[model samples]
Target: MMKRYYQDEEDIGLFQRMQQDDSQAFEEIYYRYFLKLSNTAFKRLQDRAATEEIIQEFFVNLWLKRHRLPELKNPESYLQTLLRNSVIDWFRSQTRQDGFAAERMAQPDYQIANATEQQILYADLQRAYESTVGQLPDKCRQVYTLHQRGYSVNDIAEQLQIAPKTVESHLLKAHTTLRHLLKDYSAVTITLASLLMG
Candidate 1:
């Protein structure tokens, strides 16, 4: 699906274009990371079919949330985090299936610990996100909140009784302000800036 060479473009440039709904940028990201994400997933699950599903679902979700791409300062790490979450989700779902009991028992203790750590990190990130959003200007925060709740730009505009352009302006401002604040935030909390946007 990649139409042209975007080899010269940096990750940040690609992310910006993807946020604007550029299919080429999305394709570039997919091709660039697909193999790496696949390998990462295979390593954790060790099941060919499950690994493929995880990678496929990750790319689908990535495209669906392209509008939030600009918030990712570290695409590589963020992608890995996404895959890790997917793998954990797969494991959780499999746990409820009788066929997966033996496989779950074969999994290493370290893998279990890793999943626990991920859950803790996500909880902390959610709290930090709420706190950071609280610091935003009122209208900007409301627009961002509604946007995250799946409202389209026009929907947000009509609901807030503001012009669509004003709604867009508020979204852009919120992204910028949140990015700046997250950059200066603690390291453990910093990755949340990129991860929690979606």
Candidate 2:
């Protein structure tokens, strides 16, 4: 199951399989988006059965039309938007009779978790970031610290009495090294990746 599931990670591979009506590939996508979409729908509908039915139907329709779908730059995002639209349609259909859709729509969207989870995530990110940075070579760490402190390349070079090219070199090397160290941490990955030259 793990080996089969891995085959669908790449968008191109998944797209190819769906073209041939591969159910395993379809199942992989179904499970990937199921929780997120179900949560989104339940946020609005507040009905577990209705949410499940809507998402189930959406996936059913998706499988039927998979082969003819056009190129998708981001399949996950596309599916998410589709799920949101499906929820909205559910709301509209219910509204014709209930007329209470607007109030429901005004409620907060589905949050993955509460404030405590957010704090824990932030702390984990900070630890991962600091630990990765702490593992850098002396010069690379120096350059990165200064860069984060708002130092320009030329300013960092001058302050450290190093060549501007050397400063850039250290930053690039640090970026690559930290990326490897922090690959499993999305927040850290984004923070480190954002250090590229403007």
Candidate 3:
């Protein structure tokens, strides 16, 4: 008479057969582990639909990569570790996406706030602004910074030993270059740049 096989004996036999590419053994393993793996993932993710999707993906990858799977001293521990790592990766990706979305939503509001601040701070739009200051002719840049620091155009002209008309020309040229360079940005980028310069 043949002896009866215990369920654990059946499982070990299935596992050994799986190493030899036995489809039935692989299906048996899947049936045994799927519920436990899904439950573990669900505990971490909380969302039923997302948890189900994650577990399904995990098992599919497991089957696809079965040949490369390591020899396990404890198959259950190995599976649980894989599930935990998958859940951790899912949460990490969710955090990064949330941060990016928040930054995008805040950008326009940040621009608006910056514009309100810039209105009180500087005048002359060209030479007084940092973006265009660097692009000016060397003497123009020096005269502009003096005017930005509260010197009159005449005072800048006297201090730099240039004509007042030369100071005006430098300021105008600086402004024109800034407008050209910044034309591609939205109003928000302009405001933000102004705030940063200030």
Question: TM-score per candidate, in order?
Answer: 0.49, 0.46, 0.44
- In candidate 1, position 164 carries an lDDT of 87
Q: Is candidate 1 or candidate 2 better by TM-score?
A: 1
In candidate 2, what are the lDDT values of residues 1-198, reduced to their tens digit?
Answer: 123453215555676677687766765665445544655665566565576578667877777788778788878678878888898898778667654655654456524343345556545655666797898899999998897665778899999999987987786676666546434432322322232221
Summarize candidate 3's per-residue lDDT along 8-108 as a digit string, tens digits: 33445666666676555665566455544654665566455566567666765665676787877777777789888889989887767767676864698
Displacement of residue 124 (Cα, Å) in model 3 is 66
Worst 10 residues of 1 by lDDT: 184-193
Per-residue error at 1 for model 2, in Å?
Answer: 6.9
By lDDT, the candidates rank as 1, 2, 3
Instruction: Tell me the lDDT of model 1 at 195.
Output: 43
Which candidate leads in lDDT? 1
Q: In candidate 3, residue 185 scores what lDDT?
A: 23
Best-to-worst ranking by TM-score: 1, 2, 3
Clashes of 2: 0
Which of candidates 1 and 3 reaches a greater TM-score?
Answer: 1
Residues 69-168, candidate 1: write the lDDT tens digits. Answer: 5587877788888888899999999768775666765689857875676556545545666787898899999998897665778899999999987987
